[model samples]
Target: MKRVLLSAFSLLMCMSASAGVTFNPDKVKAVYIVRFANFIHWPQESSLKQINYCVIGNNQVTNLLESILVQHQVRNIPVVFRQVNNQEELDDCQLVYLTPESCRLGELKIDRLGLVTVSDERAFSESMGMVEFREKSGRIVPVINVDNVAKNNITIRSQLLRISKIISTPQGVEHD
Candidate 1:
């Protein structure tokens, strides 16, 4: 009986590991944002004619995100990946993943556009949208800035809201 219990425990551990996000903590958070993209609704005027995923300043995370997104389709749209060097390239992206080093540039662009911005850094909070990842009690969890999202005219689905730790902000304070 003890041997059987041990086997069961081992099985549980393996399953738990497999069930968790596959990338490293930071990269997993970026991938998580990719998944979150499916749950957001852009205004009719929003430029979603093509689904583009941009990565700024962190090639590693971009590579991992590309691998993950390759297997999934969003709104029947094929995902396209791009590495951005400047804010001017941001206009075509529906989702932008910013590394710590590029957070300021991303923030500046997101503030001017209605694009979804995600980052693993705290400085991202000043942007129009953010998907902040943090390690808590040895686990990685996403904290979403729904207020920022709304400010950008991006609507987050209720289901995603339920699963994420949402950061609330006052209504009407969100700039266009």
Candidate 2:
């Protein structure tokens, strides 16, 4: 099962890479944003009403996700998209995606309440967040920081861990 998932992920990476530079990055990212919600296990304490997705900066990615996920449900939970223009917006989101232009870890309080973080920054899993979407070989792939993920009290599915390059290096990413 692990191998199968890994191969599927590799195929996706290859396909994404082969896609021309004109490929809509936001669209692909939106697909992944939704998938992440499906693959991760949020804390049981989370509200069952909906899955809150916090978008910080990158209005293009934010808008794309909002449009795509508005009608979708992950694990039977309605996926709600919310814009994070300030720290106060971070209070209620379960998933957080920080655009490349968004503020870095030091400048913001991301560790609050075990937020599952995803970012476009390079090796973000190693220092800035749990999952990172990096462009490699002309493809966008996800890397996960296992240690960081555990620290947040979140459990990463083996399928996702299989496809993701797990890193444990500490580059100053903090948590509560």
Model 2: lDDT equals 0.72
Per-residue accuracy of model 2 over 55-137 as CA lDDT, tens digit each: 88865777877876656677667778888888888988889999877846457778754689888876567775888877666
lDDT (C-alpha, whole model) for all candidates: 0.64, 0.72
**Each prediction's number of clashing residue pairs:** 0, 0
The Cα error of candidate 2 at residue 49, in Å, is 1.5
lDDT of 1 by residue, 1-176 (tens): 33443353344323334467343564545446666766887674244556778888865767777766663557766667778877789888878888777765534556534577777776345344467766665556567776677777888888777756776554323231
* lDDT over C-alpha atoms for residue 165 of model 1: 70
Runs of candidate 2 with Cα error greater than 4 angstroms are: 1-22, 171-176
